[model samples]
Target: MNAPRTPLLEMRGIDKAFGGVPALRQSRLCVGRGEVHALIGQNGAGKSTLIKILTGAYARDAGTIVFDGKGVDFKVPIAAQRAGLSTIYQELNLVPQRSVAENIFLGREPTRFGLIDWRHVEVESARILAGFGMSVDVSRPLRSCNTATQQMTAIARAVSMRAKLVIMDEPTSSLDETEVSTLFGVIRKLKADGVSVVFVSHRLDELYAVCDRITVMRDGQTVAEREMAGFPKLDLVAAMLGKELSVLQGTRRAGPDASMPEVLGVQHLRSGTRVKDASVTVRRGEIVGLGGLLGSGRTELARAVFGADAVDAGQIRIKGKLVKLDEPADAIARGVAFLSEDRKTEGIIADLSIRENLCLVLSPRLARLGIVDNRKQHEITEEFIRKLGIRCAGPDQPIRELSGGNQQKVLLARWLAAGIDLLLLDEPTRGIDVGAKAEILELIRGLADSQGLSVLIIASELEELVAASDRVAVLRDGHTVAELTGDDINESAVMAAMANGTANAAAPAQAGIQEVAHG
Candidate 1:
């Protein structure tokens, strides 16, 4: 047999720093031709730094990078793109108002005599999408399509650049099972065409399913590299977390319990295709999970309950009294707070200081005669910063200055400081580091136990839902198909529910017991 193909791109001894703080130290990655290489790490593991270095968003302090047999240094993102490298970020960078064809061939659309060639753009986009087994209308605005379609469009755009190496950051985070499998097919196609892919995701299952090799990073250093064939999932987790598998698996030191009073109850809730006929009970002193595939209506259920969306038909009761929630303020006034999924869009006012962002929701309580109490705001902000371990330069620091994880913590603090009785968290720990995830989980648990607070958490990571939830309610096709509790709330059970809407009857009863805990 011929020798194995050489790596299409290689980076050795890459080092990087942010604001004088070392973020990545000597991390190494090699992406072979026609292979999927995964990068795994906890939050703050320097994953972002490494990607930035590769994409030319940030210059590496020290490294030897060779792409397609040529040693090179990229000083800007454009240079990397021109060199056949394309990155699809976790945040889904696309102009929603633009058509699919426009987004795919944005800057370099077909032109005739200095004027744009719209007809050619659509034909090219259609042909490209057809290769991926998609026939979506390329002329329609991107936002009109479901999130999965939008993601597919992004992938198509990347490949249209003739990218030899595609960096997919959390590509499947927002995709359903079917959509995810479809994406995998596309990845395989890319590989068959001799394209190298860098896959980064918090979901280990996806990594195991697609990656040929795994590179583990921790605290800004490449810790281990292992082939996928014999790699144990637990070992992968251990590597990313910097802990042994045995040490990581166990009951939480303290977790939520059953038999809690229902702080908020919804019977037969419906909101768009995202949420349909969903019923859930969040009890005081417990963290219940809304588990499902992407578009299973987990976030939609949260939004409906929090009044972010109109409940087409349902009964919502708080403290045993039926209530009307016409808007966010109505929910807030009823002691229910929702932390939205996208923090930058819905959670933070970037121009505001950390203190202001924390107090934005609670300002009414601190206000006297319509005059804001700056002194009280400062005190509360200081208290939360210390309590939540939010890293910031000071209270005066703009909220935008913090990292993604830190910005998320501030959003959590915003709701926690309000001392709401019921919290609807949509992917509360999303995009955060492992340590931050654990910390946030612990904080939510403690708040439930100590303050009799109730929480309904929606997270895409199934392991997180399994670990943090006292009970789990799974949705499928916008309906609550299964509920698990106690012994039934495991990865298998949640997966089954999401896949086929099947569950052991004992699961719901176990969850019923926990509901009494808070009552």
Candidate 2:
């Protein structure tokens, strides 16, 4: 037998902790040269922490990292890059106003006679992009190109660095189908050139399409590792969830009753290019989920309904009465609440105390004669903190000091304090630990069941949508394509509707449910 090939990169016995809580424990990963390795887990499953350790963004408490047959410690990201490893994060870090050529050669531009060579930069950038089957003008500003082109330019920058290993984190999260195909082609080219790749994505199909080996993480540990060819999708999901397939299959609950009063309705909703002619309904005490790919108008529809975005054309009915929401104040005045996807910027007021953040939306109602009631605010904050199980030092603790899950809870409490009838949540469980996710999901179910709250939720996670939604509205290219309910509200069926833009007729639907035709 031939001699065994050495691994391109190896990480073993990794341990990381934050605030006395372990994020990773004895996590291990080994990647071979010229192979596409997939790292998969739910939010806060240590994937990000591990990658940060590898890239020197976060120092590991305990671990041994071996790369290119040598032991090395990278003190910073630049050090990692200089050591022949590069990482492309979900958010592209390139300057938007700079030309593509300038972005590619940002810090390391070629010089001629003590000056930067613009022509050489453009020629080299074009050559690098052409290698990836991209022909965009390198002289144009980066922001002039679409999201896909900008992402490709980021990859080109990484490749041009002569990196032996490239780590891509959620690279396709914002790309369309065709754009994703283009990215896959580039990955194949990189593999052929003996470059190792570490791919991280929430999309299972993309992992199945491009990865050679797979590693699954759960609860801050390496749970499973296997070849991608024969691995079952259900098995992978189960591994990530730390549950058996049978347990997951049995967790599908029944949908809510259709006879309930229609609490919210949208007819022919159109907002900009992303949301076009979309329609949906939420019944009293029911949860409706919006399901689609990243650019498929789910967020746009939510924003339109919440009046965060201007509606070009649409009719919104609240409790059988037509209403026009010209601004967010109108929606809030009508007892509507929205929880944005980006919790850090849009949801929480980090500088304020937890009590202050919780009382923000209800400030007007809680005040008397232009004066604030500090005692009443404290009482209300304490009540919500106990009810929502928000872990914090006290009501006076800054919201920024709390964990992601606790911060989300405070935001939820803000709306609850306002006594809203309908809540719009976008990726409520995103970027939180699994235990926290379960708690939040349970709280949502309780709100619908006990408090008669109608909710419209937008979630990228298919399982969350299927489990929590009484009916799921599928959107494609900004149009509501189908509405799945009962037995039809499943992972396979939803994936079919998203991929093909058509509902599966064979799947059984609940009574009184109708398909939403695209306009």
Please tell me which predicted candidate would have the highest lDDT against the true structure. 2
CA lDDT of every candidate:
0.80, 0.84
The best candidate in terms of TM-score: 2
TM-score of each: 0.64, 0.73
RMSD of 2: 6.6
Candidate 1, residue 174: the lDDT equals: 62
Local distance difference test, candidate 2: 0.84
TM-score of 2: 0.73
How well is each residue in 386-479 modelled by candidate 1, as lDDT tens digits?
9888899989899999987788888888888887889899888876789888888888788877888888998766678878888889886677
* Residue 36 displacement in candidate 2 (angstroms): 1.8
lDDT of 2 by residue, 30-141 (tens): 8989989998886678999999999899999998999999998899999999989989999899999999999999999999999999999999999999999989899999
- Model 2, C-alpha of 103: deviation from truth (Å): 2.5
